[model samples]
Each structure stands twice: as structure tokens, then as C-alpha cells.
Target: MTDVFFYHLQSRPLEAALPQLLEKCLERGWRCAVQSGAPERIEALDQLLWTYDEAAFLPHGTDRQPDPARQPILLTTAESNQNGAAVRFLIDGAAIPDPSAYTRVIHLFDGNDSEALERAREAWRAARAGGHEVAYWQQGADGRWVRR
Candidate 1:
């Protein structure tokens, strides 16, 4: 099954959910990845995941970049239009790298409009309809990751 995560960026800190989510993905032998524009949060997540899972945190891209020998999960930070690669991978419905390649796609958004959220949900559903497993998570009021 393709696992997906959606983290909502709100007034609360959404970064807090990364480590635990990564750990869960690792325990299940699922390839995991995270994308965010928040540098500090991404860095913190990386540190925690690596500290606990030791090589479970990986960095990913659309191009051919080898996974760090140390980590199996991919961590990507959005910059300029660079974040489009991640979005393209999802929107174009191309295959992502493993375990990320396996289908569990997580999308993080800054929650404000329900219509936007609905569109995202639909996109995710399309991915699933194409025969991929998917899941979602978002920043809760308390700043923790919660399923949508």
C-alpha cells in the first residue's frame, strides 16, 4: 500500500510530527519522505529521524540522485519552483523512488481554504484510483500530525 501523509501548516508548529511519522514508516519497512519549506522544521525532523532510525531519513528528487548510504528515507525542502518536482511527481503520477516509490504519498499544505483542500484530496484520490496506496496527515491545532 502507498502510504501518504499530509501536514498542514498552521499557526502551530507542524514539524513536530515528522520524527514519529518517519519512525512509524521505518518500523513498517515503508520508504518514507517529507517535503516542506520550513528549513528549521525539516532540519529538526531529519535530526530526530536519523538519531532514532539511523539512516532512515533520505533526500529525494526527480533526477537521479542516489540515496544517502546512511538514510533510506528522503527529505526534501521546497525552494523557488524546485518544489514543483515533488508536486510534479505527484500530479503527473510518475513513479517516485522507493520506499517512497511504493505509493504512500504525503502532502503538506498551509490550511486556509476548504476548496483547496478538497482539490488536493481529489488529486490524492486520483493517485489512488490509478492503483496506488495513499494516506494523508495535516497539522492539527496542537501542532501535531493528524490524519485527515
Candidate 2:
């Protein structure tokens, strides 16, 4: 069963939080695919991953790039797992793909946006209905994830 994680972004924006999570994924030797609802968001993420930290480099490429399957992290707007990623991150209200396609599926949403919140809820229900193991994490006062 796929482990589905719902991250409620309240204390910080996705830009601040995503790199850290992706870093953890890399540390675990997992390849990742980050899917966004908009192509513009994917473009933004492509830049963000490259320069999020001056000392750290998260090797990634977008679907538009050549040899997307060779990328450690592929940023895309499509639902297909082009990189053969073990983990898939759905951000910016991206539609959830089949849970079984990856080992883990992460859904991150803006807590401040009502529409985003509703979408997250729907995704949560869908994940549960699909019999995937679901977990919810919300940022605590210190900007740390506390599974809820």
C-alpha cells in the first residue's frame, strides 16, 4: 500500500518547506517527481530546486528537459511518472494520481487558501477510499512538522 502524506502548509509557504522535504527524500535514496497543477508553477519549482540553498544542490530537471527519466527529481505538470520516481509530490492543487504508482504520495496545500484546503480534504478522502495508508502533518509553532 502506498503511504499518502498530507502536509498542511500554514507557518511557511511551499517554497520554504519543499526543499527540506526533498532533501530528506534524497537522503533516503529515493527518487522523486514533483507535479504541480500549473506549468508556471513547475517552472518556478524548477528554479527553486536549483537555487534553494547555495551550498546544497538538489539535482533535478523538468519534463521539458532532455532525458527526464535520468533526473533525480523531475518537476512536471503531468500525472505520468516520467522519472520512475519512488515518491511523487502533488503541489499547487495538482490532481492526485494513482496511489499505487509510487511508494509514497505527498499532497501539500496552502492552509491560508480555502479552495486549497477543500481540495486537500477531497484528496485525503480519495486516498483513504483507495485503501492507501494516510497521514496528516501540520506545521507546529516552531515551523516543524507534527504529524496530526
Candidate 3:
């Protein structure tokens, strides 16, 4: 069973939190696929990952690239895991119809959005019942992530 992580964002927005997680994924030599509920959010996330930091960089792209497998981070609105990513991030209420293909699934939901929070709750229950290892992470007062 795939390891499922639920990140409850209490302070920073997804824009500020995701890159940090992606950076950690890179450090662990794991490729990542970030999925959004809409194509517009995927496109926006693509640009944000590129320019979020002036000095740092996260090499990533969508299917529009020449080679998807070469991307350390792949962003998309679809549920396909074509990039061979070891980690899959479901952002902005995105859901994976088939998650067995992934080693891990990260669910990052906005705490302010009641619908998103509810969706996350349902997902956690379903995944846990499916015998997957589940964990919940929340941003601490110092803006650091503490798995709760």
C-alpha cells in the first residue's frame, strides 16, 4: 500500500509550502508529480515553481516538454503518472482515481476551504481503510512542518 500524507496548511498558502516539500523530495532523489484540479492551477504552479525563489530553482515541466521523464518535478492537471514520479502530490482538491501506481501520495489542502478540508478527511478515511499508512502534517508556529 502507498503511504498517504495529509498536509493541513494553516499559515502559508500552497505557493509557499509546496516548493519546500518538493525541495525535500529532490534531496531524497525522488521525482515528483504535482496534480491540480484545474489546468489553470497547473499552469500557475508551473510558473510559481520556476520563479518562486530568485536564487533557487526547481527543474520541472508539463507534457508540453520534449522529454517528461527528464523532469525532476512534473506538474499536471490529469491523473496520469507518465513521468515515473516516485511521489505524487494532489493539490487544490485533485484526486487520483488509481493511486496504486504511486509509491506515495501527498494531499495538500487549504485549511480555509471547507470543501477542500472535507475532501481531505474523506480521502484519509478511505485510504486508511484500504490499509495504507497514513500521516497528518501541519505547519507549526515557526512555519516548519510537524507531523501530527
Candidate 4:
């Protein structure tokens, strides 16, 4: 069963939260693929992962890489998991068609956006109905993820 996670972003933007989550996945020795609904979002995400921090370096690539398997992290608008990622992240209101294919699937949404919040709820219900373990996390006052 795929462990489904919903991250409600309130205190910080995607740029602040995404890297932290990706870092944790990397520490767990898991390859991750971040999928966005729009191509521009994918392109923006690729740049964010690289320049988000000065000291930190997240080795990632989009379709420009000669080999997808070699990338530790991948940012793409495609639904296909070309990197064989252990974890899949759906960002910017993106939805995964088949969640069970990955070890974990994360649905991240901006809490401030009503549409995003609605999408997260729908995703949670769908995953639960599918018999997958679901977890909900929201940002605390200090911008840390607190399970709710």
C-alpha cells in the first residue's frame, strides 16, 4: 500500500517546505520525483531546487539529463515516473493517477488557497477509500511541520 501524505502549507511557501521534505527523503536513501501540473511550474521548481540555498546542493535534473536513473531528484510535468522514484510529490494542485506505484505519495497544497485545500481533501478521501494509510501535516507557528 502507498502511504499517502498531505502537507498543508500555511506558514511558508513551497520553496521553503519542499527542500526540507526532499532532504528528508534523500536522507532515507529514497529517490524522489516532484511533479507539477504546469510546465512553467516544473521549470521554476528545477531552478528553485538548485538555488534555494547557498550551502545546500540538491543534485536534480529535468528532461535535459541524458539518463533519468542517475538523477537523485527529478522535476517534471510528465506523469511517467522515469526515474523509478521511491517517493512521488504532487505539487501545485497536481494529482497522481496511480498512487500505489510508489512507496509514498505526498499531496502538497497551499492552505491559503481554497481550491488547493479542497483538492487535498478530495485526495485524502480517495486514498482512504482505496485502503491506503493517510497522514495529514500542517505547518506550525514556527514553520515546522506538525502532524494533524
Best by lDDT: 2
What ranges in model 2 sit over 4 Å off?
A: none
Each model's lDDT: 0.48, 0.93, 0.90, 0.91
TM-score, prediction 4: 0.96
Residues 93-114 of candidate 1 have per-residue lDDT tens digits of 1223332334456555546757
Residue-wise lDDT of candidate 2 within 1-148, one digit each (tens)? Answer: 9999999999999999999999999999999999997989998888888888999999999999989999999999888989999999999888855779899999999999999999999999999999999999999878899998
Superposed Cα deviation of residue 31, candidate 4 (Å): 0.2
| Candidate 3 displacement at residue 62 in angstroms | 1.1
Q: What is the lDDT of residue 52 in candidate 2?
A: 88
Stretches off by above 4 angstroms in model 4 are: none
Per-structure clash totals for the candidates = 18, 0, 0, 0
| Candidate 3 Cα deviation (angstroms), residue 142 | 1.8
Local lDDT at 127 for model 1: 62
Displacement of residue 124 (Cα, Å) in model 4 is 0.5
Better of 2 and 4 by TM-score: 2
Alpha carbon lDDT at 27, candidate 3: 89
**TM-score for each of the candidates:** 0.47, 0.97, 0.95, 0.96
For candidate 1, what is the TM-score? 0.47
Instruction: Summing lDDT over every window of 10 consecutive residues in candidate 2, give the lowest-scoring window.
Output: 92-101
Give the RMSD in angstroms, all C-alphas superposed, for model 2. Answer: 0.8
* lDDT for each residue of candidate 4 in 1-148, tens digit (9 for 90 to 100): 9999999999899989999999999999999999987988888888898899999988899855688777889987878899999999999888778999999999989999998999899999999999999999999999999898
